[model samples]
Target: MSLTVRILIGLALGLASGIALAEWGAAWEADAVAIAQPVGKAWLGGLQMPLIPLIFALLVTGITQAAATARGNRIAGRAIALFAMLLLAAASAAALAGPLL
Candidate 1:
């Protein structure tokens, strides 16, 4: 079988196992403290293992490109301002609708 098929099968098996465990009692149920805690910690550790090098590489490449551009500062400033304005607008809308819900 293909790699995609194998990955899908693994995902399906994982989902089925999770559902079965959830249906059992607390002792059998895969709660955060029981099953997920260690798994989550290990997964996070694996993800963070190469994060520093990846971040440094990305930052160096970004800075080099930005320095090479004539209008990079202006573009970055406008992007930041637009993002802030959109974020504020979203927060204001959510606040206004919170009471109605």
Candidate 2:
């Protein structure tokens, strides 16, 4: 009923369908990849279309708001740390998963 539940259901279904396709679509894998890959990329590009501007807007807003208070420095530090940690975690996951894949 909620957005989170819907997203979770979508993720689960996507995974299930992807697994089913991978297992049973071997004969058509090339065609499937040829078609699906571009569609997937287009979907991803659509999703990312607003990301850069949104991030830039948020970053500017944060900087402007933080400039007025001393606590903003601490908040900014924590945000940067969190961002770094997320980047590190992503890199670590890619590093670990690359060999397996």
What does candidate 2's lDDT look like per residue over 1-101, in tens digits? Answer: 99999999999999999999888877878887899898998898799667655765576567657755756777676665665566567667876996698
- The list of candidate 1 runs beyond 4 A from truth reads 26-36, 69-101
Cα-lDDT of candidate 1: 0.69
Deviation from native of the Cα of residue 78 in model 1, angstroms: 19
TM-score against native, each model: 0.49, 0.47
Per-residue lDDT of candidate 1, residues 5-83 (tens digit): 9999999999997787677746645455677788987897799667555654565566557745855776655655665
List per-prediction Cα lDDT, in the order shown: 0.69, 0.75
Error of 1 at 41 (Å): 0.6
> For residue 57, what is the lDDT in candidate 2?
59
Highest lDDT model number: 2
Worst 10 residues of 2 by lDDT: 51-60
